[model samples]
Target: MSGQATVLVVDDEIRSLESLKRVLSEEFEVICAKDAGEARRVLESEIVHAILCDQRMQHETGVDFLKHVREVWPDPVRMIISGYSDSEDIIAGINEAGIYQYIAKPWHPDKLLDSVRGAVQLFRLQKETETAGIDMKLTPERVKRVVTEKRGAAQQLFDFDRIVHAPDSPLRDVIELGRRAADFDISVLITGESGTGKELLARAIHYGSSRSAKAFVVENCGALPDELLESELFGCKKGAFTGAYQDRIGLFEVADGGTIFLDEIGETSPAFQVKLLRVLQESEIRPLGAQRVRKVDVRVVAATNRDLEAEVRAGRFRRDLYYRLAAFPLHMPALRERPMDIPLIARRVLDEVSKAYGRAVHGIAPDALSRMQCYDWPGNVRELQNEIQRMVVLADNGQLEDRDLSPRIRSSGAPITLRNGHGNGHHNGHGNGHSVGATLKTQIEALERLMITEALDRHGGNISRVAGELGLSRVGLRNKLGRYDLRKGVSRDG
Candidate 1:
């Protein structure tokens, strides 16, 4: 203790106390205590630099004992070790007892030693700061300003503007709704096809909210079994099940003051839905093999590609859970549904993939882009990204051309051609068609007009329905109707 930092290890179990001591004895002066009472006596006599206390004991909880220690001996860095990962207790220990770190049970000796060493270093830094009068130089206003600046940076990173889409994208309405919902403390359910960026929207909502300073955790609920999912979201005590050797903090607890994005939420079974519903309704979770329930303040943003309403009607999903999760629902349109956005998305992907692969490809040819827009991307944005990555890897020139596209995309539609005004070639091998001398812009306008006319006729001249089907706003569709001179037969009724 004369030269090395002194650490105090407290546990009721004799073997655990000895194990912790043995791990630290080589690097520091280690002291052991059987319980809180003995620990208080040691603290009163020894110059302890750090204290590692077991959370559970025969008489009192580690949190309660540490809270008392904080009042009496406030200098030493405090840490809690336990076989149970109860988030509520951990949070309480951190807030009330000023805990520095949490060591899970069955922790590796190297990790344990590292944690203790870090704690010792922190203790020394604090002592040096006090000795140099550095703590006195910091004011509350300075601290508040630093915190505010950090939060502002996070908000900017996850702002709604960060979401990639064209001006006329169908995602505009959904993004507007999400921006509004972010200011409120309510659950949101985002519905979309896979790879439509549901998790990205969820993140924007979280960081744009008041809870931006806190954690934002994500979990794909469809990837795990019922038991494992439960343990992941609600935590578990050591020995709760096979291989649960250490207490682990759950995502909900980790995101206590922030948001949790549960992707593919519709894949959860009815049994798991019941448990999740209970947690949502009560704002609490009970760790597996634990008798106590912990309260959490977490905002949930769930996403799924499935039609949950149909699932409920078919008795595959719970109606209550559906309603709970859909407090504010949003839908992300598929890539094919918003064809006008293809060029922008494709260019963005091209730039990203080119840089990642160290390629010189900086642009997509107009012909290749037109073909991509014609093909319906059933796999959505993710599929488009993969296609771009593949093309970048195989590209032979500075630009991505039609031949660089995958066979499926290249053959998806006819190549857009610019014929000479003198009709050097026929359009589509037909003799001297109207499009023979058409410019690229003229051909694009003709295609747009044809699509709008077909959509209007298909929806029985209902302007609103046609607009929605064409992924356009009502005003935009009206403008298109007027441009194509097809408004004469269109009805204003939605």
Candidate 2:
């Protein structure tokens, strides 16, 4: 063996246990357990590659115990040893439990060693597949596209640099605070509305930290069910569940030496919150179906759009976990909150989109830029990116103008004319009441809602036609519909 793979031997007979250990220790690291109970405890603390169990132990049969192992710790290859029983029962039990091999008593030491080596090789292959899938799933889309090269010491803070903003950007203070927080190894909780760049800020903190040289992994807590979320964060044994064909590595283990960004932390269930609390309290994780807990050194940076404090007060989020995650809380300001940054953000996005689309969109016309600045961006930076990409693709004369701006943006807060020249369609943003003396933000939102509502009604809720008639991408239009709660009436099938 190139490396010493740990073997766990379970036998009630002390003499037999000593002999097995003596023989196996030469080529592998051997740990002895007198019975099933002791074997489980050993497994909880150490990573064992294979197990050799005497079929006729005192309290429990080896087959019975191995069956249990298949449920909670199935990663280790199992072998049953007993010159005592060649019974049909024993053979059936071994087959059902998925034992790697059946060893007879008075076994040859050389053959036993060879079987264990093969088992170890099988274990290695299973782990490789598990970690490979985990690595692929955990790579964030932004990281795949934007963070292409590794950053040197000088470039460690470059994530923050990619956060293009104007001189008078409201996020400047938040960025400063995040940079300061990155110096320490404390947990950080970033709060904001959707598309407000919470994950972007989390990345900045990771790269700005001392662990910048290590891996930075991301997991969307809300994207998976609670059961799966747990299994993904803490590894699982082979056969731990349906579809678990191989031993798996979790994100926590993958990010052992670095940072794990848990996005949508507020959306996780209370049960999962308790599990996460344990990881933060103790720097260790017990993989599902595995007997032991493994120590991990990881910095956590969690992000959520919800008001966590309110969630805690309302009993939706665990208070203890909330405090643990918010040790250093940072807030990402929405696009509407810092409308001055729109031009700067828009231009940067335009440049990127132009290059990507192979277009000649050099800049935004003053009228188009003015309209963007005046309109309230419900989807924040992400929406701006979509708008800019659309402009770049449609920029026939090299510059985006008012014509390139979507109907919703250009006419927000402007008077709407019905067929009979009546001004009606405006409501209190939520479609309930009139907006007489509403703030600019509220008035713009009201107008946007009215436009979408009228479009949906006109097209009989046909999203494709509505998006085209309004000069908005389908995705952009869908996001608006969701933001303004207009989807309840719209029908995609229509």
The candidate maximizing lDDT is: 1
Off by over 4 Å in 1: 1-154, 421-494
> Candidate 2 — worst ten consecutive residues by lDDT sum?
137-146
Over the full model, what C-alpha lDDT does candidate 1 score relative to the true structure?
0.78
Clashing pairs in 2: 44-291, 44-292, 72-289, 73-289
Give the CA lDDT, 0 to 100, for residue 443 in model 2: 43
Q: What are the models' TM-scores?
A: 0.62, 0.60
Over 1-494, each residue of candidate 2 has an lDDT whose tens digit, in order, gives: 02356789999999999999999988877889999999988766566778999989889989989999888777788889888766774676656777878888998999988888777655644443344343332222333232334335424545787786655567988998998999999999999999999888888888888887656778999999987888889877666777666566677866766789999999999888999999989888887887767677889999999999999999999999999999999999988787657766887788888888888778665446655766678998999899888777777898897788777776563332233213354332533333333356644544565566677878899989888877899899887765544565578584
Query: Per-residue alpha-carbon lDDT of model 1 for 1-494, expressed as tens digits?
Result: 11356688999999999899999998877889999999987765445668999999999999999999988778678999999999999999989998989899988999999999888766644433342244543333454454456557767877899787766678888999999999999999999999888988998999989888765778899999998898889877656788776454467765667788999999999999999999999888777865556667889999999999999999999999999999999999988777666666787788888888888887766556656766677899999999999889878878777788888775555544443212232345555433433345545654665566557667889987887777899898876665444565597575
RMSD per model, one decimal: 15.1, 14.3
Top TM-score model: 1
